[model samples]
Target: MSIIAVVGDCTTTTALALAAGWPSGHDAVILEADRTGGSLAAWLGTPASPSLSTIVANSPALGNSPSTAWSAVDAMVRHAPSGTRFIAAPVRSRAASRALSEAGGTLFPLLAQLYEPTIIADIGSYAVADAPSVLFSLASSIVVCHRQDAASAGAATVRLERLAELVQFLATFGVPLTVALIGDRPFGPDEVGQFLTADGQAEIVMHSLPVDDLTAAVFAGRTGVSERRLARLPLIREASALARQVAPAETDRAPDSSRIDQLGSSR
Candidate 1:
């Protein structure tokens, strides 16, 4: 029903894992649209075949029927150990990236028409005319994740300014741009929102996820602990809150947050 695109300096994988954990009955898939290369498959230990490259190559044929396109997408999809269905980014296929840039106008519209409920795309960072930029325009909401330190905030400020320019009427185009602050920073969510509004001239919504290195390690697949290990962490809590806001209909019937501990312990 909606597509939430997560980008900027934060850990995209962590966001995807949290979103996947949401109790949305409707299927949720993470589509990695990194412009340079795909690292999601390597991080999750999934093969990179049947990835964005394959999807782009098959775009012509996929346009014929919605069923056919969905089928094609399904073929490239992989289920992460955490139970999230994903299509990894293409590996070193500059050609594929170029193709995505050229035909994204046609490709993403079909993807939106075919997929329902939610599609969370991991767009590493904003690059002008990149593959993710095309999808950015079509997304229902954009979540820009950045750390709180001075350097990061400064970069984020510049990026947000550029993003506002890229998507005119971003505040009123039915596409809400949200900033998700990750890690410790001098400014709180409110202050950061105010700053973005003042400096970038973009009315922004903001949310923050506390810095938890261990929990982040688990989400990135660098740590061997089960994802349930993060059940009590604030990172997960904030993620659940954001997920609920973006896709409440999906989690409306879901159990309370405490169920996370139960689910974790059960396995």
Candidate 2:
């Protein structure tokens, strides 16, 4: 049940995942399914598993005729660790999460059942009406990946509505969401506050992942999990705690928001 969905732009999520100690050589994991292949794949240097194109090519495995060609999809997930796996909807931005219907909500949790402690899903940057909602429907916590600019956060804020509706609709699945913001540069909470206006508000929750030198080290294939864990200071620790709180539980209820210290870093 220690599963989290890292949503939004993949441009910086690889760094965010490493900062959070995913696949951290512990009871943690980071699973990626990006068709162009995300920064995580390059960071981890793992091999190519099946992709959206792979599933698209094999659509008949899930449903009707082969000639129908990608009208339907079979979400392709691959076991990356004993208790962690990677799944990405290989279609273009809008089509990314479409595999939810093909795999059902069971796809993520099924891997979680096998992978156990933690699962980080890298959902690339596309918050369309269809697939992102489906992925959010499956997430225990969603790391809303944004850049450190005013615009990306602005986009993230607007996208929060779709997230709210999806969470409400997925009641039968059971799991509230915690939202974490990931950016490439450093920005204080006050600066972030400016963009997070009421129009951008969504009820699930939010957190920040700090950008740092060691962060770059980890993603550059320089450090291992044991080497980098707890190195980003408070931001890293808070992220791990939030991941735990959201991952293990499945219900409309989320961990108490007030008690959770929203963590970040000093410039």
RMSD of each: 3.9, 9.5
Q: In lDDT terms, how accurate is model 2?
A: 0.44
Tell me the whole-model lDDT of each prediction, alpha carbons only: 0.64, 0.44
| C-alpha TM-scores of all predictions | 0.80, 0.52
Query: What is the model-wide C-alpha lDDT for candidate 1?
Result: 0.64
lDDT of 1 by residue, 175-211 (tens): 7777777755656777666656765556677778777
CA displacement after TM-score superposition, residue 104 of candidate 1 (Å): 1.0
Q: In every candidate, how many clashes are there?
A: 2, 4
Candidate 2 lands at a TM-score of 0.52
Q: CA shift at 123, candidate 2, in angstroms?
A: 0.2
- Per-residue CA lDDT of model 2 for 89-110, tens digit only, reads 4434344435444444434434
Instruction: For candidate 1, report its TM-score.
Output: 0.80
- Candidate 2 deviant stretches above 4 angstroms: 10-28, 35-39, 50-117, 129-133, 150-175, 182-187, 190-201, 223-238, 249-267
